[model samples]
Target: MTTSLRSTLDFLLYDWLQAESVTSRERFVDHSRDTFDAVLDICERIAREKYAPFNRTVDTQEPHFDGEKVTLPQCTHDAQKAYAASGMLSAAQDYDIGGMQLPYTVEAAANSFFAAASVSIGSGLLTVGNANLLMVHGTELQKKVFALNEFSGRFSGTMCLSEPQAGSSLSDVATRAVPDGEGFEADPLGPRYRLKGNKMWISAGEHELTDNIIHLVLAKIPGPDGKLVPGTKGISLFIVPKKLVDTEGNLTGVRNDVALAGLNHKLGWRGTTNTLLNFGEGKYPVGGEAGAVGYLVGQPGKGLHCMFHMMNEARIGVGMAATMLGLAGYYASLDYARNRPQGRPVQGPKAAAGAAPAVVKDAAQPQVRIIEHADVKRMLLAQKAYGEGALALNLYCARLVDEMHTGEAALADDARMLLEVLTPIAKSWPSEWCLEANSLAIQIHGGYGYTRDFPVEQYWRDNRLNMIHEGTHGIQAMDLLGRKVLMEGGRGLTLLASRINATIERAIQVPALAAHANALGAALQQVGAATKAAWATGQPADALANAVPYMQAFGHTVLAWIWLDVASAALASDADQAQPSTAGRMGAMRYFFHYELPKIGAWLQVVSSRDDTCAAFPEESF
Candidate 1:
């Protein structure tokens, strides 16, 4: 809850995004800027009071599981409770479901405080996302029994997608679900089924933080041939609870066959329990059966579609986590720079060339704060650019989510198209560059930064996971180039370019941002050209061989657009010119334009040429 963070959030929310305008919508009629401020105030206070102080405690004291149950520190428990009590878990849900009916944009802004304070202690990302999906796809009873309870915080939720064998390839998933018995269809819950399989890398898979854990699992139902259907087409979603619960949502005192096989010992996020879960292992069978009882969600073979509702939300959540972690490191390093005095500026005295009439060489000079050094400022500016630019980018996407849900039909459709193009970048860009921000944070701390004695090292380790989770960098790359940009007859990409061009036009009117705007216009053109050239052959292998590089180039271009837009907005709003908030944003924007935006050339080069040097390498040559 640094004042710096709060101010940045304020500027982004009210000034740049014009979040207050969203309250005019009928869905958000209950909310006002005052109410939004109160929510943010409470969130900042709770995060500072309960989460910030115990960040180190949770990191050092990992979750442990005894023979019978898993255990976590009391601080983690208290923090989770405090966050749930804030009514943010269902912030965007309807008022009927215990939600305050807050706008998603404000919800994302409020959640950032907790993420910055401590990401590993849990942020209700999965719980909220899971409930949101059920609200869309689940039946009436399912919504009442699971989604509502989750929103109330009586039951926490998780999305179980990856298997040990499948990993990110949902097409290769092998988890199987079968009808429970003769009366399975007539059972009060949707279509009752029995599931038996192993799910890997389940976060918060087994925890006592709530009354029960509701798992939204992806599995394939067997065909009449008694064989599991092949590929993602066969995939279907199921709701499998940790403890058997009735339609009224009361625990039946009988446990489902889902068992925690073991915990993953990770380098970071030690506070969360990432586990290998064994379903239907006979260890906790229900009613003289070994298979875990699950209720079907949506139609058979439509599980991936339903599960995507949660996956996409989690991807955005991961992006915000990465952005906040990077900001956390930036804040830490910025504080150190302000307080730690070590060096004298070299510009103090310039002796005449070859002149002996100068001050004594041994004269003692006072050491100045590290902030006095230009190189240190470079590092700080880089962090600020990446971290703050990413914050704006993510919040912009959140704002789009609001528009998509609450805006008129045409505006909502356009928002959807823009989201399809931006989601991967929003998720992957921060994951990669923000981790670099973390690295620079450590560099600013010097040798002590890498040690456990400093918190920057831990921020680096925690952020390293963002690139691999939700979706891998490579997976997102393929999604961006292989699918997203080309979806809907390339309308999504065109919609995005139109928006970027709109920002460019606005910024061109501002003299300070004119050059940056022109530079961004060129970058966007390069991205567009590379995209067309990559697909010139109309072959997946040729186009996708350089997908990662293309994604890198595309993400940088989008960020450049975001920076120019922010700068343009600040100038338009007539912000106090002398304020550090305004001046620092200009500086960070300048840094990105001069130092970072040019690197996209090399990335787009390989992309446009469809370079296959790596793809063609022989296995033994490595």
Candidate 2:
């Protein structure tokens, strides 16, 4: 494993999880630093060996639809099988259910390796998130039938929410789930319904990598009038399997009514199959019906709430994916900078006034490695700040999830609240900033970074999809300022502030960190003030018009808090003096506090002023 990767995981397990008692709970009894390190090592080894080798191949030879079946590189299946056999597919599940029962924090850290190595083959992420949703909301039978298969890797899963027309606006979901009258009672999942709709942008939607594909679809169930309800209130979730399964979770070798309309060629993440799917189009009916049979997973009219369970998990997963890609790019660029010798010191005596002062031998005045140049170092440092800091923020969120799952009730409740508020920032910040880091990685690589020969370009391409994966930047921004901050009378925001302030107070005890702590405190206050000012205008349009800016400022402030925590951890480590990693942490912290923190002020200005510059402009003007 890379030093950066191991250090970050250590920081999570030791500096954060144990420190916060996230792994001290009864449920996480077997979790220790050794076990966590072991899991990370396995993930890193498998990721490097299996997934990394086929990353480029998967991207270039994306799933091909041959009118009869979809074909993928054999390596995709090989890599997936390796992952499933490693037991990470069920790493965080219960022991009775064949899980390793690792803490979510460790599981998240382990997953980052796969994301960094080959996000293309990271289809398991969705499957796990889907299984988690079923574990939370599905009945015992549903768990046995679908979730277990998914966790075992026999059946991969996907969250089927977006449609060809509805996109992220689930209220506009037009998919209908009519009750399967006579034969519905035989189904074990629940009262079965015939789902008839088309879903779009479904990743891993259809693949031959697994034996079966389970889709957790959101659709509307009709009321007494036999007419579909108009909004999300009518939405409900369903377990729609690609192949018919018996009550005992055995595949019956019968294809369901689901059909792949086609594959949507994407600009990025081409490694994973993105599909347009037609359900109940009558291509193959399970029980002489034109609609696909689906078993209800949750109550009708509560589908959005049920899906949010998966969406939120996937959102954090997306953030981690983004962060890993940024880190991957950073390491790649750093290696390139060190080896690809170029330009000399900008102030190398100006060539002695063009007198061609003795050409120093290559051995003496050898061209300095790009890393030795100030500008290249600046970009590299920026990437380190963004990549590592975003990573810390992600693991921190994962630790919060651990607390929510295992800590005391009150502490768990507080963790939930903070996660609710932080989720949007956690998702959006990395999707935005880490992509920026990838861009810097490319710049650090100069012209070669733009070429297909380098992995940095692919990293950028893969990461570009995350911005719109779980949600768009604008949507997350709206959620952050328009909802999360103000929810429960601002409890989440308050809790988050208290936590950051606690870190600030602790930092003040150390002279080296006091200045950064003060800067963060000021930034935190700016966010609070902006939060108040933005919402003061009762007009939601006015308040939300500058949501993007609010998210930017708020996200930066959150990163500042995370960086401070990281710096404190580095300082407190048992190293006799400042090790290179400690120095690197301090340097990154200084970069963020000096360069990135101040930009938040400009963003806050836009938010606090309730700037209508864009929102007030007429749509026709576009």
Candidate 3:
């Protein structure tokens, strides 16, 4: 599994994305191919030794809270510490803060190993994202007290969003953050406040992996009338620590007013703790108060905007996690198909004159490997197409992150626009398709797939959570069709089309890729037309009615373009050295184009016509 993944990473990083070229930029000048390889080597080794061996251990053992503290397996603690020691928590940060200043592209690829090894064991996505958000919007002192410690792994972080009542509807959040005291504005760590609310489904919400858990909470600050403001615009980000910390980053030796309400027993990702947490419930009040003390991150009422910095990063991370799980399933199933021989091939009645024979074999022959069967091959290919294609898409988004930060003016502008257009697709497409890959993997495992004895069923369960978290498929669809495509008056979508067309132009020059190039070109056209048609009446209600289908069609078109781009690159890849992996990619690309691309048309039909069958149906009928 590691070998296959390593080879794929090599091809994606060097051959396709040209990660080495980023070294030309001043931010990454200290790095090179050697430094990147060293990091990758460390991550892959740690993942294999510390994570892969313990995948089942953590899953079966799970995390248990015994009222006082959460008890995780010893192996989980070992893995978490090892990950923190890896410097990956700050791999993309500056050199001054104990970072390698590596490009996000390399960082993302390096992290995939750990995710594939065990998706359940935490990998610092929330911590890194939390710190990164602070670096962008935090004050100098706040950065020192909070973000820096998070990057150093002395502290872990989580974003507290969905409340039990609000769930996905931020506008309905009831969490309130009022000024802590009269001198709150004078405090060094930004404005201080006392928060009272309950957050639900918080991952890594309660853990002993780090010295402190800095929760970036979202809450509403009341207006002058002492009434909590409504909607997301009123939402604000806060830094609520599990334990209070002073200016010098020393532990204040006092627990915050935060209390763990209960643990959520999830179907998957059990290694990480999910909790219902209560703030300001008088559990452990500070200074005789009944509220959780928190420091403001940005301006009040702009909390969602600030939290979005972390949320967007998390969305991409979620996409990568989904891709790795799908790949893990694919690898497990592939191994089973190769060695577990099944029934012999059934021969045809007879071949017609001058016609090809379907099979030239006898029933009395030895049973062949399941891989020899075309149906199994089809399932394997679909998994490959979905998993690898999703990986490439996520990595491409990461590459854009590098460009957005380091490229020249015009290039950075283009990268920024393209990223906005692709983020939803990047998050949702893998979550939707790669899940199917897991299902196919289970199907290939036959009866064993259903039982817990095999890992494939676990992979499916683990992946099932991806679509619902980070933003559900429905949310992403609305964001894409209702907002992303129409963002900046469709400027982002236009930038995306330009990039896709450039790939089409390049792939069309190659004989073997021309057909796919044409198909993708048509797909791009269909999606563009559907985007316009959906909103032709300029009524958001009608336009977003079939948003999920539009998103599905758009995501498929984007993926088709990605596969074509990869296949075009594979043409120039080393013919002998990369023959096997390269051939596999080529086959996967073909599978995507042949079997997956056409399905977009049916999905797009609803979008183009603004079909209202589902939306128009009365809820009472159900």
Candidate 4:
């Protein structure tokens, strides 16, 4: 079996995780290095032995539904079952739920392996994690009804946010929830109102893999005045089940009210089910013998807020998954490069004195590995920067999660605020950049990358879904610039800037990193200036128009900070390693600063401009 490139990246991440524990002094609830490594080892073994071997087969023999039942490749089912039985599905949950309850950071690291192995198969596990999150925040009765079933792997869960009309705009969602006759006693805890609507693009919405599916749906509840409550204020979250539950909280059978209308054949991630669902199909009795059964989560008007809880977690998952896919492609390309011999350098002279030049077929000597080429190295470096950098960023956030939960209260507050500010970037930037890495991996493979014969192409397809997953790049941009940065009088943004400045101050003292430190400081100031000017205008839309540039600016700035931290830590470690490798460490640091850090200047320029090119175009231009 070929060793995974992702595993090597995870090894690096494991080192970072340990460093974070020492530096942050926060013990993670779910994972430590030992536990994380063991899980990753298991994932690596399973991914190589079980999943990777079947990836192409699963892709060719995609899941199929014949009117009544859906059938997937046996290998796909086996892989899914093996992953579930390994207790990986509950990584983010507490141990009481039959889970290892690994830390999100550790789980994120492990997921990289699975996604790299087979993105489509890996998605099933992600949906399970998503369901578990909702169950944690859900009511006790809801837990008994939904969470318990999920724990048993009897019911898979999906987040249903998009509609045919409301893509990213939740406020525009037209799905309606009406009060029924005292609600239905599907579970003894309490009855719930009937939910009737059409939800589109629901992942795992209607699949035969599990006995039931729990959909966390968003819909508008009627107010006392009868009109839709203003905007999202009228919106509420509901737990809509594919089958009605008994008073004993047992899923009896399929309920006709919720029917699978159609399946969406997507560009990629094909092993997972995506369905168009029609509620209130009028075929079976629902809540109080009415329409579809729906239970309210959190509060009536606070549905959108509740959804954000899951959305944030999902966003990080998206980033991690995308990064993993790219890492997989990178590893495959690297392996192929190292082993595949092609033409020699054109600059080299022919072999001397009757020796044959390196050539193919019956006439020649052995050729050099493709990896020796400079262009191949360039692609590898780009992949490393994006994939490894994203890994560092996500793991850093996970460490913050630990700090938020276990550190001193004051420190926890600061960590939480800083994490909140970085969340969008942590989620969106990697999805964008690592997908680029996947694309580069394909390029490295040349023509083979375009065919199923090479996994890099599949990696590209899988990563493409990430652009629309959790949230789109545009949505994330708006959230970062319009809300998180400006929220609470820029408290989050200030906290983040303070942290970056602290690193900048430290790097400034190091001769090797001093210049990049100065550049990052200047970039931070430019970002602050741009932010202030946007806010000063008091036009949120204009501020949002510049959101994409702001994301790029802030992403690079934070990445520089992270790179500096890593370089400093590496240099310090080299000094302590007895047999010092300070020179090599210094070279890597210099390469990053001189070659990578300068890009921040260009990013800052665009951000500071506050250009309204997006707004300048009229709606009719197209």
Question: On TM-score, who's better, 3 or 4?
Answer: 3
After superposition, the stretches of candidate 2 with alpha carbons farther than 4 Å from their true spots are: 19-23, 183-186, 348-364, 574-577
- Cα error, residue 376 of model 1, in Å, equals 0.8
Give the C-alpha miss distance for residue 48 in model 3, angstroms. 0.3
Worst 10 residues of 4 by lDDT: 22-31
In candidate 3, what residue range of length 10 has the lowest lDDT sum?
572-581
Pairs in steric clash, model 4 = 30-103
What's each prediction's clash count? 0, 0, 1, 1
Question: CA lDDT of 304 in candidate 2?
Answer: 87
Question: 1-622 in candidate 4: lDDT tens per residue?
Answer: 2354553445456443563363333334344566767887887777777788877777777778787656777887778667766666776566676666566666666666677778787644435654665675677777767776676666778888888887887888877787766434343544476767788888777666677778888888877776677678888888887777775567676574777777888888887777887777665665335467777777778888888777887887787788787777777887888888886754445678888776434325557788888878777767766776777788888778766766789998998888889899988888888899889988888888888887888888878988787788888888898889988889999998888898888888988678878987887888888888767668777677777767877887777777777767665555544433345334444555566666766655555565666778899987
Q: In angstroms, how far off is 85's CA in candidate 2?
A: 0.4
Question: Model 1: per-residue lDDT, tens digit, 1-622?
Answer: 2799999999999989999998889999888999999999999999999988988999999988886789999999999999889999988888887789898899999999999999889779999999999999999999999999999888999989999988998988888899998989998878899999999999999989999999999999989998988788999999999999988999999999999988999988888899999888899878888999999999999999999899999999999999999999999999998898886655436678897654433227888888888999999999999999999999999999999999999999999989888999999999999999999999999998989887999899999999999999999999999999989999999998999999988888877888998999999889989999999999999999989999999999999889888887777676556776788888899999999999999999998898999999999999
Pull out the clashing pairs in model 1.
none
Between prediction 1 and prediction 2, the one with superior TM-score is 1
What TM-score does structure 4 among the candidates reach?
0.89
Q: What pairs collide in candidate 3?
A: 236-303
Error of 1 at 101 (Å): 1.0
Candidate 3 lDDT, 1-622, residue by residue in tens:
9999998999999999999999988998888999999999999999999999989988899788889789999999899899999999999988988888999999999999999999999699999999999999999998999999999889999999999888899899899999988999998988999999999999999988899999999999999999987677889889999999999889989999999999999899989999999999998979998999999987888889998898899999999999999999999999999999888887876889999878666868999999999999999999999999999999999999999999999999899989988999999999999899999999999999999889999888899999999899999999998888888899999998998999999888887889999999999999988888999999999999998998889999999999989887888785443677778888999999999999999999988888889989999999
User: How do the residues 1-622 of candidate 2 rate in per-residue lDDT, one tens digit apiece?
Assistant: 2666877677656765463354567787676667777888888889989988888998899889998689988998889999999999999898999998787888888889899888877848889999999999999989988899889998899999999898989889889998788777566679889999999999998888888899999999888998888878889999999998888888898999999999999877877999999999999977677999889987778888989999999999999999999999999999999899986654433465658755433445658889998899899999999999998899889888888988789999999999999999889999999999999999999999999989999999999998898989999999988899989999999999999999999999998899999999999999999888997868899899999999999999999999998888888883443478788888999999998999998999989999889977999999
Computed on alpha carbons, the lDDT of every model, listed in order, comes to 0.92, 0.88, 0.92, 0.73
